[model samples]
Target: MTDLSARDIERANFAFSVYDFDGSGTVDAIYLGDLLRALNLNPTLAIVEKMGGTKKKNEKKLKIEDFLPIYSQVKKEKEVGSYEDFLECLKLYDKAEDGKMLSAELSHTLLSLGERLTDEECESILKECLDPEDEDGFVPYAPFLKRLIAGPPEEKPAEAK
Candidate 1:
């Protein structure tokens, strides 16, 4: 929390609040892993335990104050892979050397691979970043991969005349 910006702290608070279902000002311990994932942190069960999360229902709870440090620690330790790494991996399936692959294959890989995404999550990404599938169901993958890694292109600010 010490190194986080005001906006980042605000976002963490908002995410934590979502799981505080009972308005008890604390979240159930069992939800810690889900909460961390919701905040884009890839925390393992050990990490969750170290951060004071317990699997026993209603046994422990996390206040936002306690959650902030955990969020900051995980965020600092998270190592997002480089864009080249992703591109290389995707190229393995690009048999045609056309920088395109079947849209269905891409979705399946995302749904089944490491850190698997839920169907809804996969669909959300595809809807946003994927081009319309061709008649044969292929879609250009390079651009889609770029968008996935770097997010949508930012709009340029209007220049003052």
Candidate 2:
């Protein structure tokens, strides 16, 4: 908790969501295998399975708390802050604890990012990506960020001669 910022907290939370692959609420070897592989930890499937059978009854199970230190280490090693850094920081919000982002959550966050967006523009962006008919009214964070990253850039008017 000392070194971990809100964004770091969000990143771990996102990974935790993915690690719960079976929707079992409790993670088994299968889930840990996938989680380890996603982070490129290089454990084989067989090893993963062995891990599943080895847990002690009185021991506590793995949680995001156990994962964050490794996540923190990885983040420190390769950090190159950019606009993505802002986005990384935005992970602290973005309804990201759920690993899905709501348009309403993003719109409020847009207002607070270093460069300001008018409420109109926030509403406009939401209209473009968020479907009014979707019952959950949320989008996956990766693609949602990709859409923003890959979309057209805003341009100011040309200067007068």
The numbered model that scores best in TM-score is: 1
| Residue-by-residue lDDT tens digits, candidate 2, 24-120 | 4544433565565555444433454444422343243465665565455544543323457645765776554765666566777778755568988
Measured on C-alpha atoms, candidate 2 has an lDDT of 0.57
Clashes within 3 Å, all models in order = 0, 0
Residues 1-161, model 1: lDDT tens digits = 36788998988899998999999999998999899888776676677888888979899888988888888887776455567877888888888999989998899989997678899999999998999999999999988987887655689999999
Q: What C-alpha lDDT do the candidate models reach, one value each?
A: 0.85, 0.57
Task: Give the least accurate 10-residue stretch of model 1, judged by summed lDDT.
Answer: 74-83
By how many angstroms RMSD does model 1 differ from the true structure? 5.5
Worst 10-residue lDDT window for candidate 2 reads: 51-60
Off by over 4 Å in 1: 5-7, 33-59, 118-124, 147-161
- TM-score for candidate 1, please give it: 0.64
